[model samples]
Target chain A: DTAVSQTPKYLVTQMGNDKSIKCEQNLGHDTMYWYKQDSKKFLKIMFSYNNKELIINETVPNRFSPKSPDKAHLNLHINSLELGDSAVYFCASSRFRTSGNEQFFGPGTRLTVL
Target chain B: AQSVAQPEDQVNVAEGNPLTVKCTYSVSGNPYLFWYVQYPNRGLQFLLKYITGDNLVKGSYGFEAEFNKSQTSFHLKKPSALVSDSALYFCAVRAQNTGTASKLTFGTGTRLQVTL
Candidate 1:
């Protein structure tokens, strides 16, 4: 079974378009996270949720929002996507506190704005 | 204020030789360190973690890391590396932040290219 998975492996759209990426995990983990990796291969944390609670929110733009209906899934929504939003978005999950803070990630959604 | 640093942007090693990827960290209090590997087009895979046990922590795929308190470093090492082990490695640190769960700060990343 796949531990973590993301939908629409690649996305290409216009500069003013809207996009959403879905993420799910089957490791019975409670915490889910979103990360943005730039062209330089720098992976930075965007948002993190532990058991449906919004825990960490980095300096991501307000246009980008993460929604978690339950503990098993986390989805990222980007509104009015711009060229700067073109990058790979990763989804991750971890079992908080007692689980040593190790996160498992998804395949990733590569968003391209033209 | 926690941060992890993988000094080398890339590390090259001969396939049958021992390999080491350096990582250093800075945190205010006790830190929980982790090492993850990412193959091309894949998500980050958890390798090992240092949650307070022995200084030398062993993990998946014949990988291990040493936690040096004095140096504030957690470097990943392999006795004999394989060409297939060529991938991107990340070092991360987490502590008691104001978040609901402990948040991790990841290093930039280290690309390992094991050659034959």
Candidate 2:
């Protein structure tokens, strides 16, 4: 079974368009995270939610918002996507809020904005 | 602040030979280190992790990492590497002492290339 899964593996949209990437994990984890990989392939943490509490919110644009309805799901909703927002979006989950736990990641969703 | 470092942007190793991708980290206390592999257009895959145990930790794909506190490093190693092993590797660390250290900080990344 796929541990972590995301939909819309590829997305291509124009500027000013809004999109949402869905992420779900079956590992029964409590912490979920979203990472953005830029053109240079520098992956950075965008957001992390633990027990439905927003924990890590790195230096990201206000246009990007992460919504976690529950522990098993964390979805990213971008408002008015721009060219700079184009990148691969990854969703990951860990068993709990402990550094000792290994993270499980989804296949990733590639977003390309024109 | 907890930080991870990948000294080399890339590493080249001959197929059938051993390979090493260096990674160093800094934290306030005992570090929770990890090694993740990323293939083309794929999300990061957990290879191994060093919590608190033996210095040597074995992981998926026949990969192993040695955690050295003195060196502040957790370098990933593999014996008899294959061309398929060529991919981007990342080292991450979490500060065990930090109040909010559950989040992982990843390095820029180190691409490994296996030549025939």
Candidate 3:
């Protein structure tokens, strides 16, 4: 069974288009996170939610919004997508807010904006 | 502030030879280090971690990592390299003191190529 899963493995759209990527984790983790991997493969943290509460919000633009309806699900919604927004977005989850726990990652969603 | 650094962008090794991927980190307090591997079009797989224990930590797939606190480094090693081991490796660090350190700071990543 896939512990963490993300929907729409690949997404290609034009500039100004809006899209959403859904993530679900069966690990019953309380803390979930979102990371963006650029063309250079530098993974940076974008957002994190603990028990459906927003915890970490990096320097990401306001155009990107993360919604966590529950502790098991966290979805990212991007508005007015631009060329710079093209990258792989990954979802991860951990049992709790501890540094010792390894986060389980989803397969990642590759977004291409033209 | 917490950060991780992977100096080498890529490392090549022949199959059957031992392999090493270097990683260093900086944090305000104790660090919880981790190694993850990602194959083409796949997600990151947890290899091993050093929270608190022996300096040498063993993980899945016969991989191990050594935590050198004095040097602030945690390097991943494998006894024997396989072509199938070719993948992108990432080093991450989380500050134990920072309550908000639940988020991991990842390095730029290192591509390991194991040639047969």
How many angstroms is the interface RMSD of candidate 2? 1.5
If you assessed candidate 3 against the hidden native complex, which CAPRI class would it receive? medium
Tens digits of per-residue lDDT, candidate 1, A14-59, equal 9988989999999999899999999888889899998898989999
> Candidate 1 at residue A52, lDDT?
92
Top candidate (TM-score)? 3
**DockQ, all candidates in order:** 0.73, 0.67, 0.79
On DockQ, who's better, 1 or 3? 3
Q: Given the true complex, what DockQ would model 1 score? A: 0.73
lDDT minimum window of 10 residues, candidate 1 chain B: B95-104
lDDT of 2 by residue, B25-83 (tens): 99887989999999997889999999998999999999999999999999999998999
Q: What is the lDDT of every predicted structure here? A: 0.91, 0.91, 0.94
Runs of candidate 1 with Cα error greater than 4 angstroms are B96-99
Q: For residues A1-114, could you state the per-residue lDDT of candidate 3 as single tens digits?
A: 989999999999999999999999999799999999999999999999998889999999999999999999999999999999999999999977555999999999999999
lDDT of 1 by residue, B10-50 (tens): 99999999999999999987788999999998888899999
The estimated TM-scores of all candidates read 0.96, 0.96, 0.98
Q: Residue B17 in model 2: shift from native, Å?
A: 0.9
